[model samples]
Target: MSTPLKRPYRRRNVAKLLARLHPKGITEPFAGGRSTAPERETALDIAGALGAAGQAGPAQRLAIHVLCLRWWPGLFEGPSRVVGYRSVAPTAPPPSMSRSMRCVAPCTPKPALARVPVERPAETAAFRALADLIGSRLAIRIERDRAAQDADLIRHLAAWVHGDARPNTSAAKGVADECLHDDLAARVLAPTFLASWARAVIAEYRNPNHCPSCHGYGERLQLTAVAGSRARVDVASCDHCIGQGVMPWSKKRRAQQLVIGEHPFRQYLNAYHEGALALLRELEHRGAILLLRHLGSDLAMDTE
Candidate 1:
């Protein structure tokens, strides 16, 4: 075919074309690097050079198609000689866009002794939800309670019941007190809900909540932060002496400090007696640790 006539660069399309094709490939156009004007200008310059040379054919058609698609992907694709441009080799096969399957090893089996025991429908739900939540949130496995003796429906149900129920209060004292073993008391005192106050207290005792910053863990905490900052990056100071690292109450011994005046209970109460009493009563009814904490302060004051 005779050298194709050179075509004028459409100033309007120059930018549009450059946007569609530059740095020449299927990569995304510069998100923020070079401005659209410069890219379009470059594209126009290239187009002008091409027209001067001659109309592009099969191979050249492919190049033009690629360049065009690079910028304006909306353009149609087909084999044909239109204007002075030719289509590239049939259409190269579309790139594979399939993603590979993710590989995850199956969980290891748990020992009979380490499994969690749960019984009853509610318990079963709790165990399953706990297990799944632990796996997702804590990135850890919570084995079935090991004490479960069977795998049958009855057995699984029993296991769920056991798992859902709170550990007996006797568990803390170690020896089961026959005198204190009234079934009514046990039922009344048993913890009832997940994330309940009882559960929070138990969890704190089991693992103790820790500060992500400064490795401080437990009830007492010292907080440290830059003076001007709103504590975005503050770290927990050692719970002792507000970051002194020496626990002020430690020297006095928690028991000794419990003697009322030795601690803040009486002083706090004298200053806010009704409020303190109301809070204490509320906390006691809730079975929270407030009694132990406040009673200690009260007794310490007496000793002083």
Candidate 2:
């Protein structure tokens, strides 16, 4: 029978130290575990350190990143696959069981509203400050070739916007195919395109007719009774606006505001409104992807 080999004395000592340090087993020390409290505290410390080092933008980003990681860990992982499918046939519930499910009427989704882009200097400054944070902490670098291609594509798009804003019939089969088909490109350039689109919309269209009660604020403050027999001020959606800051204007009013005939105004408004809605939808859809990309870049830098 072969004798069992024992671990070296030095190795045993190191293992003992690690076991003492961890309390539990030292296997996969760096792997994700159930101890989220420590992670939260560590994240707070990192944010504080970054802030103290005069990296406010990075600190803010790190805080946001930590919050996202806590709330939506699945965002960093792959899509879940359905392991099995259920039977198509429906079964009757138990006789003793009470069915509490109610039939709810389906409602149409409201159309997105077109709005003027209000210039915010403070926001712009903060955005610029994030450039350094992204560059240094995230370590996201675009290749020269890729950067050039993007610039060229942006120039082409800008030229098209400056022109009659018509799709090239020779190249594109239809407006939908031309605009909505390129998902990756749309996601990558959503921010830039949305900014330009907003500016154009503001310049071309009239200001939205704001709600009278809320005065463009979607919510209102109301006093409500609490469990302690005390009233507290709570912010709620404005009843008059139905949570939308802007109210829909009549055709006549819209046409008068645009200083154009109703027929022409309708056609123009529809085109612009549809485009705005599409861009907004694209941004909303791709927002998570962008956040993940940034977070991944930051993590990659740290790992390196």
- Compare the candidates by lDDT and give the number of the best one: 2
- Residue-level lDDT tens digits of model 1 in 169-283: 4433332221123443233223342123222222222232234332322223334565686443322335433432111122123223223232333322122222322332232
Off by over 4 Å in 1: 1-17, 20-43, 50-56, 77-304
The per-model lDDT (C-alpha) reads 0.30, 0.39
Q: Candidate 2: list runs displaced more than 4 Å.
A: 1-200, 203-206, 227-229, 248-250, 256-260, 263-304
lDDT over C-alpha atoms for residue 252 of model 1: 27
At residue 28, candidate 2 shows an lDDT of 35
TM-score of every model?
Answer: 0.15, 0.25
Clash pairs (backbone) in predicted model 2: none
lDDT of 2 by residue, 1-304 (tens): 5333222211212112223223343333212223323221233443343234333365444444332222223223343444444333224433342344322423433344444334322223333333233322211222232455455556556657789566454433332232322443334234553344333333222245668887654667789998997996766789997875556656565456444467644643434434443333233223323332342323223222
Q: Which consecutive 10 residues in model 1 have the weakest lDDT in total? A: 138-147
